[model samples]
Target: MIPGYPKETFFVPDGIYLLSHSVGCLPVSTEKHLSDSFFRPWANSGGHAWTNWLDNINAFTQALAQLFNSNAQNFCPQVNLSSALTKILFSLPTPTHRNKVVFSARDFPSIGTVLQKYCKTLELEPVMIPQDRNLADPQTWSDFLDEEVSIALITHVVSNTGQKLPIRDIVQLCRDRTITSIVDIAQSAGIIPVDLSHWQADFVIGSCVKWLCGGPGAGYLWVSDNNIHECQPDDIGWFSHKDPMSLTMNNFEYAPDARRFTGGTPSVIPFTLATESIKLMHSAGIEHIHSHNKKLLSRLASQLNVNSPCQPNERGGTFVVSFSNNQKALQTLTSAGVHCDLRSEGLRLSPHLYNSASDIDTLAELINPLLGKRR
Candidate 1:
């Protein structure tokens, strides 16, 4: 751990805030960054603003690339995960004969909705594979990738069920079948260390607002060097062009890197906050954050297993846990100031590095009364 940088403390209110999986709480440092950046005269002033703004954007992109284990040439900043994915998906070149994209049904609605909209307009097929609830069985994905798959879009960790899919295996499978693979790293980016070189994904998209604790609008998209040529730039912007000063009227030429994925002027202030957040993560070391987050969830699971209204899945350690309680018990948790959400079968709680054992104790005490007879 770096000296002089104290571990951040989060104000999660009296109620349980287990919804870090949905949207993370802002780091107190990020609030300070935002406040400081907002008061800068150059940010709100009319002159020389573009220079300051663009410089900040460049720095943020470099920081994000370092976090993702890629070169700055391989990354682009975006408003959010959905916006980044939309630009990348729409940019894939349409083959004269082949026009299909393969993905799992477990993907978030953001990816599903946009793909559906594009399929209707382009007359292409959006192939969704069967999502088996049992993630332990690797054959589930193996069997899905057995057919004629063009593009494989997958989530690193499922939000609804807290299942960690076999991303590397799936990416390799796609490679064998000449398919493009896109990875959604929203739930796993900062929580777990990622190496795109080993994962070998064609494209990856994620948001800093969740596990990274960088506040809203801090998101990114990464394009692999090989597949960078496979996607077209549908949503063009001057920022994406190779020469911003060139007054070529009739031609639109994009940079030969991930900058081709960026659309317009991104929110610069958010980028500064994001860079600071990444620096904090780097200082603590990603492996340390991973261990810390897992420890918090493991403790929470232990508390629930001993006295809560559900059984604990001990192996699931992605900073997210779900308590198997009825609708009434779910409401009780919420009414008590636990800020969690209900998924299909349970109430979800995802604690980040800022969460402490006392937080777990507080949650356990409130939820103990809701348990039933356990065999």
Candidate 2:
């Protein structure tokens, strides 16, 4: 029953945009915000624009802090999630005894790839939970976090399957075992209510391009205050210095907070664009948007054979449903102006605040006949 969502605030595609799980619809104010915050400063001040541009990045972190219910000082902007993970993996001291780095097979392939490639050099064994194992079960993770496990990468939500994990419980399990936990919130951040304080994970990483409606290159990392000092990022630069303006080439000290993860000159324009979209999401309230999305998903679920978790709380904003002929169904849905994407698991249909019940009805009507039809 949440109302007053300003759908006009975003520039939705001509067809139904159920692809927010991939790339979010652009915010209508993105251009103006970019112009005012980024382009104008560069145009007006040229070399002197660093002050405003840096302020825009700070504003981006501030908006993220508010959204996730945590301190702004705990966040450091990165180019993307993969880079953030790389920084974290390289920063942590190689374990003396615990040599295993654990992740789920269901996790986004990029994460597994990063772990596989890096663990070899780091002398850590990359252990993946088998694809058949239930990732949503806390026991499944507890069994995997043996004494040999030093680090665990927990995806807050499975991208392809729309399965939401019990991150808090899993993080607690890791904490009990003295295993460092890195929670990936890329799929869950904008749509789900994320309270970093509650999870208290050692580290959390995500990108703004997906559901945040922020353009690419605005990824961020959040390190716990308890664990921040212990991290010594191998990827340090002037930006990671205690004082970025110190100009002391010989005496470089890491910034005492999460800024230690920042490397070199930060990308300013992406943060500028992200700050605007984040502010827009804040204006609408995440809880309200979550409620609206669930309602639409529920309506759609009633008509479709959803492959995602049956319970609303067990899934993210996106829902996965199977089709007899994946290509044909995708083509039919596209032809009918119902935009969505096919993952290896199934077709993913994501509904945002801009989508309505009628949109779901349209999707159902078109998809019902294509459910089990032969090609």
Candidate 3:
């Protein structure tokens, strides 16, 4: 872990917090950023506040780029993953033959909800990947993509089961097949390394609230340098216009970079919060966070009498512990001051760098009653 890091950066409580996978603990610096970067500028500059407020957007992208290990120019800020995915889905050229957007049942429900609406559009279809199948191999999705597939949305790490998909191979396969790849790194952004160049991903979507510690409303989308020129998003507004100030509605030329994916007026508050979180994470380093979590997770996993769904190495920073009644188990832990979350899979326990081994032990010990077996 980054030495003397989380102790200074995080504002976590004394109790065990095993829900970083769901929503991260807020940074102590959040209020400062929100005030200085957002409200102070707005109150002082009045109507002219767009100057540094816009600069905060740039800074936010830069922070995310540092976190994602990609170009700041390629990252476009959004409100949520659903909106980001909406842009990508609507931006696609209406196909004459190819019609499928392939994803699994285990994929984030919002994605399925978005695609379900678009599937009815001309030349757009939805192809379901069986979540019941083994995900141990990263190349598992390669077999699902064929000529009929127009786009592929892969969840790098599943939200419920904490299954890390084989996105590198899947993206490569999409490239080989002339298909578009949109990888969702919502659960993986802070906990796992998502190098766009390494994966050769066409597009990547993530959020700042979880893992990044940025809080809610900062949704992020990264468009690959190679794919920008080919995409002309239909979901754009004044911001996406090449010369937004030109004010010629009839003449529509997009900003030549990832800003091409941007639309309408932007949200300044979330990015202000996100900027500090991303910067803090960059200072701490993704690898360090991953390493620390792995060690902490091992401690938690060892104490669980119930079977953990994922092996320590296979998942991201979290794992699922099943129970006869997962909700009751979750309530049992919560009432005792152990704050974890429940999902379709089971009780989700995610330990970040902020969580100590003692915290993990406390969670494990407190969860004994839910295991349906005596400790």
Candidate 4:
């Protein structure tokens, strides 16, 4: 725990606790926020809820917008990024003749799975760009750009490889070919800078539970204004209406914003907790937090590069780091109290802003010998 912050009053001390990208640890502030919301839900519910909800939500969205250098109006609260993605993907207007969606093999399964099911139902194609060693080469992506590509979904940072994709360039590529670009920012959200407005991306899906330090079940979706008119979600609920409880029968008006993506009553407790977590991140300053995270990743990589299976050039830039398949080494480190995770072929260390240099040193001390033994 850093000085002055004093651990924010709540955190579990067991385990190495360096998996913010996977699931962030809730700060004490969030604990308080949820507790307060629980004890006074009626006081915090309805128009009063919307009033306070919108206030906190707007603040949360504004902070995220600033992080992405986007307009606050373009940001809307949702259950999570996956729900948002489903809303947008399912709501797209039927394309003329070409109905295929294109994305990379490296993208998270959720993106592809949703598109695949949607395409099957629509009698369209799902074109997945092939990967070379789990890396989606830009040329392959460009080559897939054609009349058949109605939507091009990609991730800003791969959850598995931690590789950061050139989302801006991909956006431009999609626009030139008239393919809608959807980017999943879950793994990259707070740890890196993303200017969705500047990038001109059509849709951005992300979660608050990752680098943002929010607890589980909290996420957000950013939709470009132009794309809103193209979406007519079939799963629209009463909350999606412009005036959900207007007491008028047979009158439905969808919100002229991204709020249309959110469904029925949300998990308010998690949302409240998430809001507090964002406030904490904002108070710390996102840029400072990002810098701190980068420094930690840099140090971790430096320590692991010694006789490691993967080369420096192959490393990804986020909090997660991947090494070529080394389960034995991973098990060795895990058993040593240096908490790290592995996926398929790599060991990932996703440290948050709260972690310190001493943490990195501790992790290195345990893993170095393990790698040496492997050699």
- TM for candidate 2 is 0.97
Q: Mind giving the per-residue lDDT tens digits that candidate 2 earns over 1-375?
A: 236556787899887889999889899989998999899989999989999999998999999999998999999999888889988988988798998999999888888899888899877799999988888889999899999999999999899889889999999999999999999999987888899999999999998898889989999999999989989999999999999899486999999999999879988989999999888888788888888889898888788754464357788889887776888888989998888999987889999878878888988888778875744
Ranking by lDDT: 2, 3, 4, 1
Identify the runs in model 2 with alpha carbons over 4 angstroms from their true place: 305-311, 372-375
Winner by TM-score: 2
In terms of TM-score, how similar is model 4 to the real structure? Answer: 0.88
State how far residue 246 of model 1 sits from its true place (Å): 1.9
User: What lDDT score is found at residue 115 in candidate 2?
Assistant: 89
Model 1 error, position 358 (Å):
2.2
Candidate 1 vs. true structure, TM-score:
0.88
Off by over 4 Å in 3: 372-375
Clash-forming residue pairs, model 1: 15-337, 15-338, 16-337, 16-338, 16-339, 91-232
True lDDT of residue 302, candidate 4:
76
Query: Per-residue error at 274 for model 1, in Å?
Result: 1.9
| C-alpha lDDT (0 to 100) for residue 365 of candidate 3 | 79
Please, what is the whole-model Cα lDDT of each candidate in the order they appear? 0.70, 0.89, 0.83, 0.71
Best of the two (2, 3) by TM-score: 2
Give Cα distance to truth, residue 157, candidate 1, Å.
0.8
Q: Candidate 2 at residue 47, lDDT?
A: 84
What does the lDDT read for residue 338 in candidate 1? Answer: 76
